[model samples]
Target: MAFNYRRIIVKIGSNVITQANGLPDLQRLEKLVDQIAAIKKSGTEVILVSSGAVASGRSLITVSDKNDSVATRQLLASIGQVKLINTYSHLFEQFSILCSQVLVTKEDFRDRLHYLNMKNCLEILLQHQVVPVINENDVVSVTELMFTDNDELAGLIASMLNAQALIILTNVNGIYNGDTKLPGSAIIKEVTAAGIDFSSFVSTGRSQFGRGGMITKSTIAQKTAKLGIAVHIANGTADNILLDVLAGNVTHTRFVPNKKASGKKKWIAHSENAATGAVQVNEGAKLVLTSTKASSLLPVGVVAILAEFKKGDIVKIIDERNKLIGLGLAEYSSDKAREWAGQKNQRPLVHYDYLYLQG
Candidate 1:
């Protein structure tokens, strides 16, 4: 099927931007900028999620005696982000395309206020025909709060912007159904709302500068596709790959989107704080939440409360097996939930506007 989208999020992996020596390649970056300029001229909005800070830093800094520890990586990122964004700005300017830099740590999205601010900033830039280049703020991020990789960050950004598609540019063409190097290995052309398994073909090797491998990209594809955004994993190193993928001319793996969740529910579901607390429910409650048009989650449905949460906080609703069934805004604190657990005639714990049904 031909894929046509007006808004897109393109993610460039570190491997695509760095050489074996871990230095940024200006020529390659210029090529990408040119393609983005062409897409923008076509009147499509594009957001770029780029990775290369640590790799660029590795080229500039000397860690003579120190081991490759977390601190060393953070220090390199601090030095590298400036170089990365500067190079990008220069390249985009050559095409007369203005660009803006957006650095986000996981905490930025975790906090509601910061998330909204980031969204607004990107929207404003797009309004002015500026491409917003995003990267993780690795320099100041604590290990516990750091984003796992750029793939996860891209997914969050795509969902936040309500993008039509997300293109993840990597070194490989796409997911293979068998060994990638094998003679007969076939590219998985399309994936519906149902998932795909490519365990045998997934690369275990990390990129020279990035932490993510194919597994993380696949995970991101799955998450974003579930939110009704198509995801394409194509080889960034290929000639004009970004443009080809956007035009549906590239040989790539495409994950089709599921039906969309409501705007408020989508935000609540994608909230980073959703997993902080949970309410376990009986099978009947799960059905009710999934099917009923009711406004409130009745007390009779909640089987148990798993963690402490406050009113207006997002919380996960899990089944007995501990699998996530849905997400909802809590109507009461965790303490209140516990008090009313297993009791009848209590107020609804979560309202429907705050609930997101699981895919």
Candidate 2:
């Protein structure tokens, strides 16, 4: 079978791999692993972002109700992670394939250096024909530092690795236009634009075993698609779901990709929350930046420095209305930006190549 993507990131949602009781389904996991192994053998590189460590832990030991939710989660992750990885290892071994466990937190992508380091490590593993089974470091990731879910993490990984496509496996077939349980509701097959809103039709309820619901998935899908990466949301519970989606013969929602972006811009695109400083630009500057012309953020365009940030730090570009325009890597510190604000003939605060404009 011919696959469209040479490299792909597959994210298996908790609900797709767990039973209603929130326990790991070994049979389902084995079946998925077999499919992944076959794809790997076909010379397609795969990176799996899987959830279910907590669910796996839930079956291993009973935690006291006295512990807060966060503590209980940490405990579950710490214990369940071992079982999760081991299960993957054992299943992959049946097909004579090697899979590596890669645990990461949000801090790993906080800066360019850290981001590149992670990219290098994963690339090396792929080069050696080793599949990387990546998961969020749930033990250390707490509260604000945690990823929205594995879907968000998968998007970041796809962007970082410049994967050709991202396949998100969930319990449902795809994103529906109305209530999923409704008889007349139908799945939206293709998402070709970013401005399309599904708020009126998409369900907001979180998954039984995952933190994020369809809303979060749609948001991440749009963001990933904007960066020139095809995204597929399909049902994992169905037989041959992965292979069928790859073959384009399945009922799933696909987000078409835009023009490809550079590596720096791709990183900047997902670093909205990582920005440490902000710059409020004049109306003229905002207009020029948002226009069709290729432009850099210059000191003359910057009307005010709203926050402190060092050189190389991610900074937010804002308009006079205090609305975010985009994110970019700062060429100079905020102190330097302040000294040169509204001054002409100064170095650009952010180069066009490092800037990422949001839709």
Please identify model 2 stretches exceeding 4 Å from their true place: 1-3
- Candidate-wise lDDT, in order: 0.83, 0.93
lDDT of 1 at 160: 91
Error of 2 at 157 (Å): 0.3
- Measured against the true structure, the TM-scores of the candidates, in listed sequence, are 0.93, 0.98
Top model by TM-score, which number? Answer: 2
Task: Kindly report which residue pairs in candidate 2 clash with one another.
Answer: none
Query: Model 2, 4-78: lDDT tens per residue?
Result: 689999999999989998789888998899899888887789999999899889989998999999999999999
The TM-score, computed over Cα atoms with residue i paired to residue i, of candidate 2 is 0.98
